[model samples]
Target: MRWAGRGTEPEAVERFYAVIPAGGIGSRLWPLSRADAPKFLHDLTGSGQTLLKETWDRLSPIAGDDRVMVVCGRAHRAAVEEQLPKLEDRNVVLESEGKDSSAAIGLAAAILEHREPGVIIGSFAADHVIGDQRRFRQAVVEAVAVADAGYIATIGILPSEPAIGFGYIEGGQKLDVPGTTAAYAVTRFVEKPDLATAREYVESGRYLWNGGMFIARADALLDEMAKTKPQLVAGLRRLAAAWDTPERGVVVDEEWPRLEKIAIDYSVAEPAAAAGRLAVVVGEFPWDDVGDFASIAKLQSGGRGSDLAILGEHARVLADSSSGIVVTDRDRLITLIGVENIVVVDTEDALLVTTSEHAQRVKSVVDALKLSGRTDVL
Candidate 1:
């Protein structure tokens, strides 16, 4: 984003801490995404950088490298560190086990709050794709302004279609929030609706796609979380107190697994919206969470020369009147003939074959593997 003044930073970014919660082993994008090396570690968008690196490139200018923090699972520690070599040892916090979103983000907030009381922190998902950096940063500045006003602020994407894959944010009245072009009061957050309901929401013009982006002061987030989940707040506070000390390992191992396992939406966001403590800034940028193979196909880089969307080398695939998305993870050539709307993932060990219509159900294949004790593939 261009600044009005010469050599100046964006508004409210001095104290803004961009906390990246890099958890979750993407199961739907499995075979390519695994427990040891998740999707964030790979270049899913065909960009030179990985998803996590792209996330850094977006926020580092606003939050600086010193204020950026990453939280991830213990298993992916070496990989994350290798990707982010400049990240400080104290900035990257590792969890002993995956305790869901609430624990991962809340722990990061508590630790930052211990260092600086009431610091502005924004949490962005690691695997989302943003097409417009200028519009996204503009929304971030507005969200930080809303956070300064003591509301748990979120940057909701303006819907381009009636997409049922993402949750919806209902906006209420517009408020004259300081340091913002426009801010709206969030009425409530709704889960992914069916096709008919999603269409109704889009037609009503009262809904925005929830991209899981949240920004607020550390104290405000913790205090709001305390109302619904006091036990989680207490345990996180204990762990935060010992985070910068030598006892960090001992405290995390002892209190981390015992913390409440829940998503931040249930723990703070939904309740805060009901009480009028949540606000939203509309993001004009094109965004996607990259959840399934269909989204992958759409985000794939190509000029529509054919119906095929390939994520790797064109030489890897030799198609004959076949149209689908092919993700080449190995050096072997993949040949297809007379295929339509198909999703083919070729890897070294496992391969995923399905259609775009059934891409969302790929997680059930992982479930079946678990049920049959086929941990080798998962």
Candidate 2:
């Protein structure tokens, strides 16, 4: 991880573009994170800005307003634009349907590469809460340098705990890069392991949590993908050729569905790692996907994980010798009396009551809602 203080002014990262793949309803966040209104569209962190807007605020300085692009489903095109008014309409890469990260990110890379040959583009999830923008930008700058050195660069978060919820990246053979961020060739990417394995991974010191930030030259990213998914790359190129033209909709309708529905990790990253073409830049700045209510609790608590986090007009929820998380919309008064480690989410059509310990199971609740045909509340 690159350790540094926040700078006075962040300089624009030259030749570096950013793509935010704003897809996926955070199901674990349930009642709040609905299909039409996802968590990214709300201020889950109680930061007075939606997660997407926060992401833009942190990234725009580095990539510039014009250079930062958003790849989102057509359903979210309006929300993305509404949150980031400075973003150009042409920069919003609208997907007719969800085709996962590879299509979204790959198409962005294809268009950027076609427009400007060697621009370094980074794909960061729009919903991620990244603290310490100075350090994040510094790490990104280092990642760009690593990418310029002809390697697929990724940011790996330094593991703070034996987290079994995220993937792990093993750093091997440090690269000789004269830089601040520690750059290393990724030995392998491991999936979320068991609790015991996660503990071992944390203890090993060679492993870092996969923060899922990929930065590389647009051509280099596609060239690497060409090695494994050549046809996907070809389809993306065709789509890119029509990206800025009047035929964008026609081309997207014709080819987007046919393009591979795999993730960038499978389409390019993992393969590149195996071929010794992937590097991981250590990331130390605070980051979180806000995967569940537990995650939201942490973000809302101002880093004091044990504090009772109340989001959205906390004054309405009365607490009497109780501690936990309570999220309300001011529709009704909620009285929590002698309740410990409890979570209460009150929405118009749905309410979720669970403890932080059971927050991970919220996705199961969402799944059940879908199975029971109660998706309207979902």
Candidate 3:
């Protein structure tokens, strides 16, 4: 596998444009990352920078402002507008409704296709956290170069641990292509595995975490889409044809609801892999999807301490609060004397107390609350 480092130069990249698909409601990270404010807007890293801002910062050097586009749902228009003041009002493509990743990418692709031909596109989720931004950027730069050569490419994360939360890519053998630093022919893409299977994948040394990062020319993607999932591609093509027309953007909002909800991974990458048409590039950069609260617990002190006061553990008395996450709601005293493995969320009107282990299942509670018509709790 190929590893990347800061400022490590690769082959010159193609004309690059980035599409960030951020339509998720983030029900899993409820108290902090709500439907109104998803995980991308929150400071999950404890670094004071939001996930989308960090992603924008890392990608800015390569694609720059004019080429960077954000695809978010209508519910988050104001929040996105407030956060990214530099972006033009039109650059933010507001989905009339939230369908899924397939529709989001299709919308972004339609925009890019109209803007420029032979454009290399890097589409990624906004909430994922990449540790080595420079290396990550370098790896993307390399992937763009590979894409320019007419192959659908994705950045496959080298499995650092037996992570059950992530999908894995198998059958990634090193390639001997010219001017290629590290490209692999993807044998297959596996969905999330059981613990035993995950352990085997990590130990096998032939698997990589499917980090859900994709790169390819817009035309190449459309071509693959046409070949693999023609119905979805046809709908997107119709959308692309009418994206810029005055009547389309303002009046054709109804058509989007009819669009199929599919993921780029399922519709494009998996088929390509099965047909031996997909290229998986080994990425050296550290990555995480940051899906739910359990991941949050892992990020904070490896979820070890109950009395693990994040901001001020040593200064104050934090006794018998072992295995509790004491996130202060206000600038008040947060002394947890007796708590264990609970997530203490301090929101304005809501306070959630959930065990760290079952934090990922919080979305079910949110769904149930919605079913009960209790918008007050949600």
Candidate 4:
């Protein structure tokens, strides 16, 4: 049988170009995920592989060696290079100034456009955790089919809990597209709801947690930005116009300082979602944004009632810690005696202690430190 959009012909698997935005300094993880050591670099789940490495492994098969790109800040460039030295320096586009996701994704889009026209690009966050790789790849394949149909596709995580921290996508109407089983025509893009609203959404069964994973053709995304966010488009275009030139590439030292700072969600995704120009796939994988310490804890083996003994019972203990996190750099002897719903993070310079429920507000602490010019702790 032929695919829906391909019209009586078996649709080919779309060539994928992955763009990983690895530029954030995770303050929630505090001293562990500091400015010098970004969250993507840390062993998020006590696994040997870091978050960034896990993301790369998932995308490497789909995007191949040259097609995968990582966009990060200049400060973290060498570290990122050390992590993934196989990727060329040019492919690892660095922002001289720390702009948000908007400018970062725009730069990535422009670079990919120069390489492949109408290429399907997957924008994966550098700090997410997916439990099942097979299911994750299946979702990507489905999203690619949706993108090939001239739609900006985003994967919506199946919300197991009423998470007020995540934005919600209402998706009930299945789109009639090929190469996909459950692609939805997005009806509404809801902002992060309050606890009450989030509860309602969970009950309604019409919403999925905004996964922050997006897929679209490079040109399509740029076109949407041009229509919805003209100024942002203009700024990116000006920077991209000189992309191949020796002047810009040789001395981004000068060119990058000129680009504006904004997040891709504000610049592109939110606006496009508001304008009814986005598609959503209810991703069939166990997914977590890993935005906070608690989320990371849940993904690991010692989550709920599970004894994950890297050592003896006395050495490692995570018992009855609902909605909490416990991590220590001291591998010799680390144990949580009796704690419920708390974040315990011990690092070289700082030790963070906070309630698990207050995980979302952790970013504010990072913000406060930055406001006070505490880059040493950041």
Candidate 5:
């Protein structure tokens, strides 16, 4: 974990860092994803392990347990530690408050740079699910190789559909990287588009869903931040300097609140792409961020019954002429009669009933709850 000079180690033997940014409430999941226990802490797929733990499992083989780091809020530090017991205490970077992804990932990059020069770091979200582990590892390996060549690399998931929920990356010329077969120069990063635009993007075959996975040398990432978000870079560098010292907590408490709240896309990736420093590796693996309840249903259904999906093990669902989705954490029997395209989420304290089409609007329920000052349920 000490700094060896740049180019001292071979590309294969060089250290690669995996940074997990675990700091979202997942409001679209509503009652299931709450303030104390977020979506990342739950096993949405009933896989027996939480999403955060699964993320760690996926990255530990590529980066090793010692090199993997998680940047999360101080409030959820205990939960993160509980879920990932094998994670070293020092590898968990705690933010005093939520300053968004730019601060989270930039601080992690700055700290990693301070620890070891010429280190490659990849930032992945804690709540995403990857179906093909082999393809995921392959994509990461290619991304790291591209990063080693002095470019900011990202894993661009091959779009299986015209999804308007996620952003898109337009790839330009194909790169001639040695290890990767489908590396491309990133032309631009576009936001989530309308239905017609998404259709056009998919039909054109030049676009990939932006999976939010970014890889780069720690020094390079910090340098990019220095150009676009100089003040954040300065603060992160200052905090990183004191990271291992006794004043770490004091410095973080003082500096973290003052940092600007911005996302890494706006702070670095977009600007860097415009400056011709971004590269992307095509990730053909099945990937989903599980943004809403409809996505969860799709994941659980296995495409067998698109009209009806059940999401819990103990949910004794009796559907008679009913079709849609039902999710229950309790052991009680759930009966649906003559219902169509409806969603029923039964928890101990909260019950959400809506249509499958309105699954994306669950966040509105959370907003109304907040407006009513119903912190007890929220």
Candidate 6:
């Protein structure tokens, strides 16, 4: 892997720790992604290994088998452990409840900082699909170099299209960090915009899709948390101080619930970017967050103009002059004759039938089910 530097400065080769926060329910990808068994537990890519396992495999080469940590919910602890057998019990940080990305990542960082003062920690999601492993690794290496220079570095994926679903990161002038090329100062972070704004951003070529991947020193991350969210930092510090002690469970149970529910993007990233304490490394690798069914269809179809796409094993799907996607977990044939641009998710207990255009609104269905007291399907 080639890396760009200012001069002949030696590359920062330190022990890197990868902290994966695997706590999302992925409500949009319902049926397949449920409360008891979230999306990360299933092999959405049909690669035999689950998404959590894939994440572990992807990071193992860089962080070593032992240095990689996972922060997940208490309910999914068994599943995470089953998928990642190499992960130590100590390395699997458990959250009492879902507090959001900030708490999950901050807790992991605090524990890592306590274990090793200067450990470089990179937070990558458990459900993201990353193509071109070499390019992804190259970007991570560069991000680590930028992080070593004491900036919270993020990998900003080069936008492939004007997608209104993902946020954007506006990049500023390039930084003078050594052993890096394409490291830029982050101008600002923008939320998911309308199609018109997204088109403008793509045409301007100054924005990158926010991939939610961040790399920085454990201490640096904790320090930023201290500044932006002092209460969160205090609680995490208390938990980290007791992480390996006998009172760990008691401390977490008492403190975790009181921590504010906030995302890392809002609690740290955006604030840090505003204060000129953030850097973005342009990542051109193919990446997808697999947010909804439409994204899954795109991945399965290989972005081809196929009228139909199927995701799952033993799915005897037969479509005639129809354009849609079908996912089946049952042992039966699914026939689509004339439906166009539809999405059919067939599970044992629940089957979801909706148009692909409404893929982003599947979360509403989840909410409706909750209101109707249909927790069995949820």
lDDT of 1 at 43: 83
* Two-way TM-score contest, 4 vs 5, winner: 5
Q: On residues 1-378, what C-alpha lDDT tens digit does candidate 1 reach at each position?
A: 223331354456667999999998889998888988798887888887889999988887777777789999888888888887767788898988888888889999999999998789999998889999888888998899899988999999999889889999999999788778768999999999999999999999999999999999999999999999999999999999999999988987789779989999999999999999999999988899999888888677342424888886543788999877898767688899999878999888898999888999999998999899999988
Better-scoring candidate (TM-score), 5 or 6: 6
lDDT of 2 by residue, 19-115 (tens): 9889889999889889999878988888789999998887887777788899888888888899999998778888888888888898999999889
Model 4 TM-score, 2 decimals: 0.87
TM-score of 3: 0.89
Q: List the residue pairs that clash in candidate 4.
A: 4-178, 101-264, 102-263, 102-264
Q: All models: lDDT? A: 0.88, 0.85, 0.75, 0.75, 0.88, 0.88
**Alpha carbon lDDT of residue 176, candidate 5?**
87
Q: Candidate 2 lDDT (Cα, whole model)?
A: 0.85
Count of clashing pairs, candidate 2: 0
Q: Which parts of model 6 have CA positions greater than 4 angstroms off?
A: 1-13
Q: List the residue pairs that clash in candidate 6.
A: 4-180, 5-179
lDDT of 5 at 361: 96
Which of candidates 2 and 3 is the stronger one according to TM-score?
Answer: 2
Candidate 2 pairs with clashing backbones: none
lDDT of 1: 0.88
Task: Residues 187-240, candidate 5: write the lDDT tens digits.
Answer: 999999999999999999999999999999988998998898899999999999
RMSD after Cα superposition, model 1? 2.1
Output the better candidate (3/6) by TM-score. Answer: 6
